[model samples]
Target: MHELIVSPFLDGYLALRPGHQAGLRLPEHRYRELQAAARTEVPLPTWFAEIAQETWGLDIDGGSARSTLLVREPSDHGFSRASWEINLGCNFACKHCYLGLKEFSGLPWDDKVRLLDIMQAVGVVWFQITGGEPTIDKHFQDAYRYAYSLGMMLTISTNASRLWQKSLLEMFEECPAYRLVVSVYGATEESFDGLTQRRGAWKSFKKGVDAAREAKLPVRLNLIVTEDSADEVDAMVALAERWELDHHVYTNMTPTIYGGPESLLAQSSKHLRERTPFQGCNAGHTFFHADPHGKVSICKVGRDDQIDLMAEGAEGLRKLGGIADKLMLRTGGCQGCQLSGSCLVCRPLAKQFQEAKAPLANYCQHGQQK
Candidate 1:
């Protein structure tokens, strides 16, 4: 296993370890020096050895760190992060699911490997593997292993339904994830199973949670508050505390991927928090999203003018900054809104609310007017 991953991050270079949040920033010249050392199998720099020893207690000494260090080649592209949906298939049918059609289709093994390679070529150092439920995908193990072998720090967004499996636990132990973001539906079996529409799902989730805690895996809980689960928010927080993990509460609901308003009905209006003003992001500029079939988009919510990664490869990413710009513009119902400057939602998200024919108050400042 590699002890450190050296790669180009944002504007400079970074050296980070798997499952560790702290990282060392490397200057451009030093990064090039490390690249040369990696190519020639020379001993690592004394400063690097000292820092590694001081930081992570690694005993690199004056020996060649090349054997245990993964140094990625710098790319012409500025992309440093990406998210890939491994599959849309999931075990539970939750009411607030953003994906209306949770089909289980994904790339074949060969294509999956190729896509990972393409992402690597574009300097994707921070990678996230997500799905309607990634742990249940048949090819998830192979895909995750290959991605880890490439030395990209990994994060998985899962529902925790399969974390209890011995095979998965062992695999996760071998290749530690940076984090496992698990979504929690309800606090108890009765409410949980009822909300997911899957009998015994709550039991499975509890067992999985117990097993994960036993294994000491880095886990975080996402409390998805719906009308049904709203009353159990405190219980959910208490569960996270008992498990000794961090948790985030989400009360807002989004439209389904196909612009259907059904998911919005699950929103707990009483618990809805005010959204911060819309600020620009680095979605397509520094990071992008790829669907299971390799179609690339600006972000998860903004999916227009997708670039087919399987067809264009990494070179196609050059078109994304332009696509992101186009999507940022205020069009549709938003073009005429005078409150656009202070609108809480961005263009892509507002468009969804419009398509759903949601009441303006649900998303726009115009509706909040007296």
Candidate 2:
């Protein structure tokens, strides 16, 4: 038992175990199943089976139960949802950003309608709009207005660079139902500009933050931690306190930039190695991101197109929940993992990649997980 406990695989997992993940211990059998599943052109079936065998010691009855579970079951009345990279456009070029340097061109009127209709049909009570930065798009106000019209909780994920504009400030005031989530890369201008690589972004960001506070809009602040700026955490906390805003500081993961892995290894913090396997991550269950390309994924981190939303619509979107169900059964190296709550496990890895790669590392306590 000590040997098993000492093994790095199960290190953090022993503390807080998930319901489906506890007590199951067929490592060899699960390994074989996972291997077989990996070889298949489409491994969703094998993935489902692997999870069932590990979690319940029971078969999934040929994936039918899993499929039905994903589609028919409405866990929390479809309360939360999100859309990602609507246009691949962002004004700021943050080194730690996953979308990386993509600019947002306004979505065509038809596509915008399709997205709105999807939200209305899905009964998604809460939704987030994100991109390289959703506010950078010229029609960002339109996006907010459309979502607000549906009488749903709306949130925006942005760098807060553009919100300094007076026009944007007025629009935010009109929409009290909306929340603004700003990402602060560091505690000071020098630290922040170093990450964003923009000369005056720090000032613009502060102005935007002030605008949101003055407008009385609900705002959540995100701090992306990197090797360069990690020491500023206490300062960031102080800033959050001073501003009276809810804050989170997350480890940086390589941004999924189209160009290359420029900061993947460089910017990652010492905390990355200390992190234990993820546990209790309910991304798909709590919130999901559907990209403009119609790929339904758990978050921007584990973005994938295997579960195509365009083909299946709301039903397809719900299929992502199946992926989450399967991940709960993944426990061998990950069970009782401590760092589980420290990172965001985007569902696409369990659904498609199956490689146990770290989820969104940039997320701190507030973005998701505890």
Task: Look at candidate 1 and give me any clashing residue pairs.
Answer: none
Stretches of candidate 1 above 4 Å error?
none
Listing every candidate in turn, what is its Cα RMSD in Å to the true structure after a full C-alpha superposition? 1.3, 17.2
Models 1 onward score TM values of: 0.97, 0.64
lDDT of 2 by residue, 110-152 (tens): 6776776776566564567877677766666787777665544
Estimate, for each residue in 75-135, the C-alpha lDDT of model 1 and write its tens digit.
Answer: 8889989999999999999998988889999999999999999989999998999998999
> Whole-model Cα lDDT per candidate?
0.89, 0.58
Error of 1 at 187 (Å): 0.9
Error of 2 at 158 (Å): 1.4
- Considering every candidate listed, which one attains the maximal lDDT? 1
**What root-mean-square deviation over C-alphas does model 1 reach?**
1.3
Scored by TM-score, the top model is 1
